[model samples]
Target chain A: MASPAYIAVDWGTSSFRLWLIGEDDSILGERRSGEGMTSAAQTGFAQVLQSHLDALAAPENLPVIVCGMAGARQGWVEAGYIDTPTSLSAILTGAVSVPGQSRDVRILPGLAQRDRQAPDVMRGEETQLLGAIAADAKGEQVVCMPGTHSKWVRVVNGQVTGFSTFMTGELFDVITKHSILSHAVAGAADVPADSTAFESAIKAAFNKPALATNLLFTARAGQLLHGLTAAGARALISGTLIGAEIAGALSSAGQGAAITLVASGRLQTLYEDAFRTLGLTYTTVDADAAVRRGLSAAAKAIWPNNERKS
Target chain B: MASPAYIAVDWGTSSFRLWLIGEDDSILGERRSGEGMTSAAQTGFAQVLQSHLDALAAPENLPVIVCGMAGARQGWVEAGYIDTPTSLSAILTGAVSVPGQSRDVRILPGLAQRDRQAPDVMRGEETQLLGAIAADAKGEQVVCMPGTHSKWVRVVNGQVTGFSTFMTGELFDVITKHSILSHAVAGAADVPADSTAFESAIKAAFNKPALATNLLFTARAGQLLHGLTAAGARALISGTLIGAEIAGALSSAGQGAAITLVASGRLQTLYEDAFRTLGLTYTTVDADAAVRRGLSAAAKAIWPNNERKS
Candidate 1:
């Protein structure tokens, strides 16, 4: 492969992050902006990029690559989603070409499932997993990435085999704030990572499993009848949903696969603790690392000959 | 009392429907408008009243009584909520005067509950319950008002005694559209509501009770293991939650209470079926009818001198 410089970008629902690198994969100046997919609609694509590019003092003509919601139908360019059991190269092949004045902008395609009888799709996370896989260089490594819509992806030979989405973040918010579960929640305050209360909640929910619903009722009934505080009850409900999410993800990936957990914020801590409770093994990787790698994967794809070698 | 006609407006979150109610408890004229609470911040308070008043051909200076979200903290007048066991008259007596309005517009306060450790407040549902209580004229009755945020209220001696709010509609929408529950739901264009299926879901959820979460998992597992349709599974989840809501309301109200059921749209049908499932002895009333009675109750309070014989 001919040596060439690469650029990477991780664009999401509410935030945008970009990076510049060389043929050897050494990092250059990196930039971030609040111009996520939502605000990008108003801020304009060119402006969000310019603001960050200007700050980085990087050449605009570089073959810029993008991953995440930026490729969504509402985003800058609809790169589309690569179907399941497809390789990262398939996404590169499907990239939506965005004409950049000073540079070549290519939006990485996301992954999708249309034949499952239910058409579901994803874009950004696959790029992250590809980066993780490329970095790991290990065989049969699975990546569990947590977010508003958490994903459990399987990979083999630097190609994403398959993945499933879970609306864990949204569910947690809803159950704790809007549902009967809110009555038992202690307060609006965040439950500390690996806290006994949260850990206990995880254990109870996964253990009894059937009691999840009845446990929800306890949020209200506990406060009124059993004198459980709203905050505590909320935590209990959160623990249950999250624990269920972990179980759901594991079941989707199928057991016996090696695990690599890519996470951040409180969820990672809780998930780690849950892993111990369930007697599972995992390697926790920082979320940003995978995202950066995701950006690199896209960069290496369009300008294949320019891809950096380790 | 001073020859001034008192108007009671049940200005909801989405619509502004007012009663140009007379002190003698007679409707002079009624007005409707698309302008609601959300648009109030832009339309201006004076304009909101003028637009509605113009439709009814009523004078702006009339002693206007307002309930519902229109009297929320950010409403035309921030009339606070009264505690439980509150009388319609007591709330009217504690009305907060709106600023800059030439007319004497008394925005009747809603209800507040600090009886629990944390304070919980409610506004619009209070007036609807007042209307239901007034219309029934029964000593003790429970009003099962269904909506996005459904409220189960207890009225005793024509007063709102206590109540609880359920995020039923919101939860149903979230689950069917956004969660694993969505996997089970048939597209609206595809499967129509089947009561038998609904009944079966309720029985499965309530029978063993603890099976609610397991039942939810079945939405995913049934699709994988048993080949259950996502649409059908969604229906089951819908049936279960609604069934749980009905069970929750009935249990909260306890026995030996006269009950009135209030709802509209598909929710009305679902709730009706749910009430039927529980064999509840309830008096069914149209949503609009209760709102008018609620307005009439508020009007009767401040304009007692012009009271009409029922």
Candidate 2:
């Protein structure tokens, strides 16, 4: 195995993922847990980090680079934010070091669109943006990062002109579990995915995003009127939220801007399907790889020599 | 005081209201409770009705007219629906009699729009529509009934052309109580209303309804970036939802259709503010009176003599 060069952690609101990178840019070790900011806040952020490092048996002096909610105001050490419109690479230079830590630890700052009309902020996605887009990329790009809070960024050349956050994933969750739609989607988890219902919902919401909430009601109405299955109801909710989000995100984008989607696992498949259903074209970047690559970029930028002795 | 003519009941998803109507159409007695459909389903619908009726000391032979969820499939009895493009008065004729009841009880039928693409159903609001709009009313009318499941009905010359059900109020409730935005709105109930924030959100969402979910996130972002208070966050969510709902509801209406708002209490005020913010003119109808009037219409149609010893 190549000797470990540095550590990279993507510490989000409810998730913790740490990666030990090798000198040759290979994965040397890995750790993942639910000890994200919420849990870490309760159980001391430094203690949580050290426990993970101890379990991985990482070197004592191995410098660490972090991104996401760990840098949030409520997070450890408060890494703060970098105001837009800023170069994507500005995140690399805006890393805030953790004070009183034995190891050299740094957390990347998030991006904040201080636009009074549309004020928005993003934490972990900024790192993903840093890694997903090429360093010398030209032309406009509409980058979408899907999650609990889906982010759509307007990138011109390397600059992030602005971005918008859609509460799509969280809304889906709450609506499915907490709203009247919950009864409509009960037992859906055991069934196979409903692509037809999903595609139709995507088209409907994409065509009339204003009718998004009304569209959500159709989950129950469809079941009552057309015998729509539980799986179909679930898909309808998911597709409607995503479709409306895409419509809003692209509303302000330049015509024919290259669409870049950074997502992993289920979200990756869902968004790709949405884009296809909407007849929109887009490129895909693995979110897991993107965040890791982002943390790696930050590590190399902060520790140029990649030397343990430094 | 005149003897009781009939008992009018509006039993909804989570609320139940009963009123004893005199021969003069006056409210002789009234009772309200949380024993709506969900609760009555467990406590026995007939028993719940009897408990409330007994509380009012209504005559044993007094006929009762019911509307709302009491007629749903899982309700007391499946009163079924009156399919649309039908006349509003059809609801009076379509009510189904509850079997084995001592009293002449009739459950009002809901309205169902089986448009294949936009299938929708409303149990209680049909009665409200019957009372809110006159039988001889002419021209196109857009009736806005704001509630948990807000029903926006399109009436053309007394005929129910079609309607849309927006899960606006329910979405607002769930998002506020269950989503991450819940944190942003904590303690909002303790603060005064923020009309400025609400109005701006209304305009923003009304103009760009597609950006609703994105606009919702601003509640949190606004707090972080602009020091927005909990009240502002609550208002933002409310306005965004209502604004989007109005935008969708009116999207298909004929140009300059008279807007009729049927609501009471907080919803009445909020939707009124929303309409004013969007520069839309609408006349308000007391929701309580509309439902009562609707039940009264049903009672009179079913029991024309209103005789206790029929």
Candidate 3:
């Protein structure tokens, strides 16, 4: 078996994923937990990282590399942000070293679009973007990294011109669990996906994005007036949010820019469905693979000598 | 004092307000409580009503006129709905008498816009609309009732055309309390309204309604990037939601329809500010008075004899 070289972590707002990379640039061990920034902030980020490393029985002096909220102002150490229109390769060089650690540790900085009117910031996803698109990629590309806060980046040639963050997933979550629509979506999880309802909602919201909230109300009204099932209501809510998000994202995209969707699991499926339903052409990239590759790129750039086989 | 002729009540989903009307249509007594349909449904609706009535000590034979969620399927009694293209006066005649009640008690029917694409139903707002706009109102009138579920009703002449329900207020609430943005607005309640932040957000959202969810995320990003105050974050959330709502409402309105804003208290102030910031002409009406007048209108239509001097 190959020896573990370094540990890579994607510590987000509410989730933590760690991968042990071998000297041959292959994954040797992996761990995932709910101790993202929110949890780690209270429990201590260094302690959390050490505990995970202990579980994997990592080498005593194994170096660690982290991307995401762990580098946020409130995280382990504020790695700060690299302002756009920046090159994808710039992220590899902007890694900030964590001081006072027994072993060498570094965290990648996030990307910030400081447009006064549409100010936006992102963490962890920058690394994912780095791996998702090639360093010398040509032409206009719209990269979508969908999750709690979905990011839509506009990359012209190799430069990230700008990006917009839509609170689609979090809004859908909070709306379902806390809004009056909660009652309408009860028992939705027990039922299958309502494709018709979902498709129609996507179209409706895409056509009239201004009516997004109005369309959300129809989730309940549809049930009350047209006998729409709980599953249908849930799908309608999900589709409406995703639909409006796409509309807003595309509205600012460079004309004829090819879409590259970077997502995994349920979000990937939903976003793919949404793009198809809206008659928009797009390609998909596995978010997990993208983030891992991004971390690998950073590792190779920072510690070139560590990549040799044992 | 004039003899009590009847009792008028606006029993909503989460609130209960009752007024004792004299023979001359004067308010002899009034009662307000949180025993709305939700509470009343759990604790017997009749018992709740009787307790409030007992407090007011009304005449045994006094007829009662009720509106709002008390007429909902899950409310006190199923008063059903009056389909749209309905006359404002039709609401007064569509009151359903509660069976098994000792005194004559009638619950006004809600309005249902059974448009397959945009199905909507409003139990309480229809009454407010009836009172806010005259029976013989001329031209195109856009009635904006801002609340938990803000209603924007389109009335042509005296007939109801259609209405859109925007989950603006409710979205603002859930997003603030349950989403990641909650931390951004932690101490907002302790500070004064951030009008500049509010107005700019309104303009941004109004100009591009599709970017509403994106704009909402700015509340957090703004706090982090620009050192925006908690009050600024709160105002930004509110303005974005309201801005999107107004844009959607006016999008479907007639070319020259006058906007009538029916709201009370903080909502009234916020909405008025939103309208003014947008440079839109609008008239204001107290929501409390509108509902009361609506109940009174229903009472007169049902019991004409009870409205005259004793």
Across B138-199, the per-residue lDDT of candidate 3 in tens digits comes to 98899999988999999989899999999998998898899999999997783238999999
Q: Pull out the clashing pairs in model 2.
A: none
lDDT of 2 by residue, B1-310 (tens): 8777989999999999999999889889999999999999999999999998988888898888999999999999999999999998888898888999998898999999999999999999999999999999998999999989999999999999999999998899898999988899999883229999889998999899999999999999999999989999999999999889989998978748889999998889998998888788999999999999988888888887774533
> Over 4 Å off in model 3, which ranges?
A190-192, B190-192, B308-310
TM agreement with the true structure for every prediction: 0.56, 0.98, 0.97
In angstroms, the error of model 1 at B225 is 24
lDDT of 1 by residue, A29-93 (tens): 68787788989988788778877777777764567788888887778888866777776667657
Please name the candidate that would achieve the greatest TM-score relative to the true structure: 2
Superposed model 1: Cα runs more than 4 Å off: A1-4, A134-142, A154-161, A174-187, A191-194, A208-214, A225-231, A305-310, B1-170, B173-268, B271-310
What candidate 2 gets wrong by more than 4 Å, as runs, is: A190-192, A307-310, B190-192, B307-310
DockQ score for model 1, please?
0.06
- Give the local distance difference test score of model 1: 0.67
Candidate 2's displacement at residue A177, Å, is 0.4
Candidate 3 residue-wise lDDT, A141-216, digit = tens: 9999999999999998989999999999899899889999999999888322998889999999988999999999
Docking class of 3: high
Clashes of each: 27, 0, 0
| Chain B TM-score, all predictions listed | 0.81, 0.97, 0.97
Looking at candidate 3, what is the lDDT of residue B33?
94
Interface RMS deviation of candidate 1: 8.4
Better candidate number, 1 or 2, judged by DockQ = 2
